[model samples]
Target chain A: MTNRHDHRLIDGRAVQARILTELRAELERERAIRPVGRLLSVSIGPSPEIEVYVRNQARGAERVGLPFERQLWPADITQEECKRRIAALNDDAEVLGIILQRPVPAHIHVRSLQSAIHPLKDVEGMNPASIGNIVYNDVALAPCTAAAAVELVRETGLNLRGLEVVMIGHSEIVGKPAAFLLMAEGATFTVCHHMTRSVAMHSRRADVVVVAVGKPHLIGPDMIKPGAAVIDIGINQVSAPDGTLRILGDVDTDRVREVAGWITPVPGGVGPVTVAMLMRNALTAHKRQVASGWLPPATLRGP
Target chain B: MTNRHDHRLIDGRAVQARILTELRAELERERAIRPVGRLLSVSIGPSPEIEVYVRNQARGAERVGLPFERQLWPADITQEECKRRIAALNDDAEVLGIILQRPVPAHIHVRSLQSAIHPLKDVEGMNPASIGNIVYNDVALAPCTAAAAVELVRETGLNLRGLEVVMIGHSEIVGKPAAFLLMAEGATFTVCHHMTRSVAMHSRRADVVVVAVGKPHLIGPDMIKPGAAVIDIGINQVSAPDGTLRILGDVDTDRVREVAGWITPVPGGVGPVTVAMLMRNALTAHKRQVASGWLPPATLRGP
Candidate 1:
């Protein structure tokens, strides 16, 4: 039904499904040996948008046969109280992973809460230690969205070694972590941020361009090299000319797709893969916990 | 006596002297209120080369009025024993900072030992948490060599914001951390490594180029843009044409300097500044320890 030579719209849903399928089998096999623990989602304050994320994560856990829980704390909780509760969660054997929902109360320091979560149980990969591990090339656990972007790039079947990648954002979570992940894969990348004089000048010369700057349609066809891969990680809400609200990515997907050899359509691209990555990280946390003796290891095989 | 327009050889000794002077004054003021602690250098084995480093660090500490001690463990010391000793040192009130010398024994897991050192006492900034802190723009404590490269660039009085820079090599301690440090200063940088297709192509377009790969004379005049600043962090020992051994930097300094507006000579460049950074980190560690209540706070002066 589609031209084979035409730009391949990288189906993120397909990639997510594939990864979830593999994880489901692995989780099923591991469940027989040990009792897996539940993931606790800690929401400091009320934010309607975060609920969407929590629901998606809950669904991903369900699909993968992992237990998940939602804990909503009062909006006015003090930073000390938040950290105290997280410390309790860290010591709980049944709590294999802790997810701290973002946009906490004005007074609470988010980084402090993240630091409180034990590194082994940092399923979201937000802890400073988790991020620092990427520098040493220990990236088995990394931020979900950043890991997802790399996963999608891998799905394109492009060799990462020596790949010239232009990462157009420098955010701590996504852009920066993604750059380190690419570096681990031996890709040479240039990180461009707001201060970058000409973002297009760098992007046009890359074999791959990853944009996470949160600007709708910031990248267009003219900025991409023909046959290059484009991974759009930005999710911005914009209003249509006819007064309708819609979600858009940093790239002008429609036009850029014509030039890109492979392109990720944002809503269906990085988002689904991100949720999948969270589920994967949760499993990794379980394995690490068992290995660390915090949780019981698998029983010896039958003689 | 010298041409005003000629390439200025950035003096690392001058920078080191300036930093040490400022630190001496600050240390004198702090010492009047509270007693300072000593730095402990942990050498895993008997490396003749490591003694040189230890001696330099001790001299730097003496100049700044901080106590310094060297603790060399047996070459065959178990990894567990090494960590146990480090843990003990971490708890010692008199021990302000810990430095883990490199080229550790083949049997010892160096990173595990480094991890054993408490973050506050990690004056060398080799801890994962310290390195990770750079991503969040908290760079007060970072790897000494990486920080020195940045300090040298600052010495040139160049505006870091939007500065086009190229970093050659991607070592964990030097090039990688330096890139993050540059990112914190709002510079857009490209990291080139062994896999880079054309290192010169990236270097020739930058306002600044920092090279840390240990291959002597790896960078030459053709790789640099005129009037650019070059910070060479490599320290390599090579046999000269006369069969004499000498230390050389990654850049062909003599030829490259003609094109570079500013350059750091091999032995007098990153090495001196690196030792100064260690002393500075020791001071930072002492302050942090005081703030955390691990040590007594400074007494208030008369109103």
Candidate 2:
């Protein structure tokens, strides 16, 4: 007799407050014509989980009106002075987006300061040329937890083409960029890592599973398939049994929400839609640096 | 009664003559200590199938000693003059490796002259930073038909960690870099494509399938699984009902080599180990441009 609150939990802070209210109405119509881009965020040493994820990304970049900053440095900086301050925020010009942050300092190589951040100001897409331009689907700044786990598997409306999904962590920042953004949405995925000999024989024939393997629960309820659409993107912490320390994910959400039909519930799922996909990848890296002329486009100033 | 040529076919010219005799003894010990790299091969027009693939990559770069030039051009060039002659053979410090050659001329932007070559002389890895450095396993130079279909699935010696695989075709040059080099050798892959709803329900539960969908037979022998390890990576051409023209792959291989225990055939499999993996990606792009000091390291001059 299943029914553990009959599944469907995926609210991710109401899908990160409806993508920060459509990125605050497209940054108030591109900041009423001009001067908008800022992101930055660096942080070299300090962790209380990187200052609670840089104060929840400066309160989701001031509730999506964008502009965030932060910087910091000295925890014995050198990694060539933190890649010369991330190559001066990749030659600033009002830095559209950057993001370094992580428990840095063990001789910081962090993928060479995430390959010295400029895949158009890598907005937390953590550049390897923005994860190899998601194999030429030409993904614009992906990886905010693999674009919030492919936006919670497109909020379960399903039909990501021939969707079979299954992912379960292969990481290079969230299971191979969430299986290259679910193979650019023609999903027929299945990555399963830690050399998956049988992650429940590919998550019980997935229709969508996701997981992101940090492992606390390591998916259960016979690795769900009943009404699939799982998504987890784990954030483990564990320790309970009265020693308290909670926060767990990689499924088993009350027995996979009593046999899944849409799950995602670790501290309200995919962590507030991965901080609203890092403020929609800082307005998609400021509309690809204003469509590659590298910024300077939104003009029309004060009427 | 399955004997349609029992199985174990994977020869690919005996793994391209054991990887061109260990890249001709590491290019005769780095060309008996000196002058060793040159691969260019550009091409723009005159295509009798790109002059039979630049005469099989200048006869596999002169039977592996290296130097293979070609360059061509005028089939109505101009994609900014083929990205200014591939950025002048990417600043030719003796061109180490380039290879643009395809059916160019449809207003040229062949991935913008393959991003103007030079992901350290690309060596046909078709750079998006060498396919996003295969998500930081930092694949020296991949995509020679996805590294000859993961070296014919490691010559089916299995044990790519948890080996399940499947792949079929997502193609960023051979199914998403052979599912990111079989998820960096810890397999359990599964890409499938053409909106895979049921590529025989994930190739009858793979143990290793691979196909690379250029779709000829599209994998058969009841979608292999009996003894798996298939690897096809399609070549396709077909016409022969005595109307000549043959070559065919995407697996049917005389009925999936009677339920594949290891298959790989269709013109001596993965087409001559994808030209000996483009001469082992031109000696792995001249040992990554001599380990990124950008050449000048192999010196040992005259005995």
Candidate 3:
């Protein structure tokens, strides 16, 4: 598949459209009983950057006919405010899946705010319970990025078991949980973080290397196994000749593609799948809460 | 320092004594305010094989003044009966730790029995809650064997971080949890189970090798790196010329000793430390229960 596999590329827009089509019917069935199937994403501040990202997801949810909205707050929002809003969204039965946008203002206590999200509404799996479930290999809602990581490889019809997979980062969102998920699948994995002394050496040995470190083009051709599969989860911004910036992946695309058998370009690869996962999360949340009262509230649907 | 360090000849007895001493004191204090702390181990039938093993552990707990007792059922104890007794123990608070002696016929519901143990009293850390905590890298209790493995290696005061440690076998009691613990401490770990293709290649590459497969002298001098640390946690029986049985570790200590810089002798090494760890688990259980106020009913309390 050419790297031109734009938005619908890896799991491209078409596959996503097909997925959304399924979710829409279930969502309408959900809204038939309840007023609406709700999905509230917590976006701190109206920075055009984060707002655009949130809007893209909102648009994706809308396209699926699943009603969704972004609860935007100031960038310098207080921990109390962030948590209160998340709790409010959680309490609202209409709000099924809760998404807390990343880079949630470094100083605003995102870690503490994460708990404010009820486990049921916690579609992103940021809460400790969700994280524990991941470690225990329990079938609960997993973190979105981790979900995306799994989808990226699995969507390609690859079996991960017994693969020497290397995850390059330890951030709870993308790296750590992904490693645990991979481990639970019986894949041999190693987690290399900032303190990892020989990350390149380690990466070079992997049959599949999944990089999530938000560093622009940190990995090159020499750091990969020949014909290895690479998924660049990181999107770093850099300036162009016109002084305008563009998003670049952690892997040096041109150089890595030579050695990598299968590579996901930054723009067209993991991005579309992640949005699909969100819509799926919302659909699942709606099914559990409004559709099937048999599904317990202590899981799945959460902020 | 000697390869002949004995399980009967080590500080395990001393540690067990200290635990009893402390438990006795605690018991007295509890007596002053509604007393009882006893432990009952249900033994299936009179299999001398299982007897000897459970007896050693029972002796350790007895030496510690745990008010230890054993209830024996026939060797052909039915699954229903075993399940009934285990459920009874879970309801009986006086029984602090329930060790359904191993070698219980394989057809029995082992997972069911394990799940029956109350989380607070699961000193062995086999309870799902404790296992969940361990997976989360939480400061909760850990399985005795795994804890002993860590304590045995950490006793050397060696920095485990950055060490290439290889663990053989994947029992929940020993290998799996030990690997997770070591990984959390930043040790690079590789696991070889029954299905592992090349044990020698993995073992030879290990800087610190933990073998607990219970195959007599399976790991030899040739399977180790020069000056590497060898921790032999396995205990297997071999026949003597007199037609007597002798317990031996998986590592060929006589020869491996010369090559290994540090090693844990079969009898003296992990076994006694395992008992000590069990005692620690009991104390840990009490502390967590008392601190959290999440203790179960009186039926689950100690005598």
In the order shown, the candidates' DockQ scores are 0.81, 0.30, 0.17
**CAPRI category for model 2:** acceptable
Model 2 clash count equals 1
Q: Which stretch of 10 consecutive residues in model 3 chain B shows the poorest summed lDDT?
A: B6-15
lDDT of 2 by residue, A198-231 (tens): 7887889888888887878878888788888888
Order the numbered candidates by lDDT, best leading.
1, 2, 3
Better structure of 1 and 3 per lDDT = 1
TM-score of chain B of each: 0.96, 0.35, 0.83
What is residue B193's positional error in candidate 2, in angstroms? 20
Best by TM-score: 1
Model 3 residue A276 CA deviation in Å: 3.5
For candidate 2, the per-residue lDDT at B173 reads 76
Stretch of 10 with least lDDT, candidate 1 chain B = B1-10
Residue lDDT tens for model 3, A9-55:
25445456776788778767655555554677777865567766787
Q: What's the CA error at residue B194 for candidate 3, in Å?
A: 5.2
Best by DockQ: 1
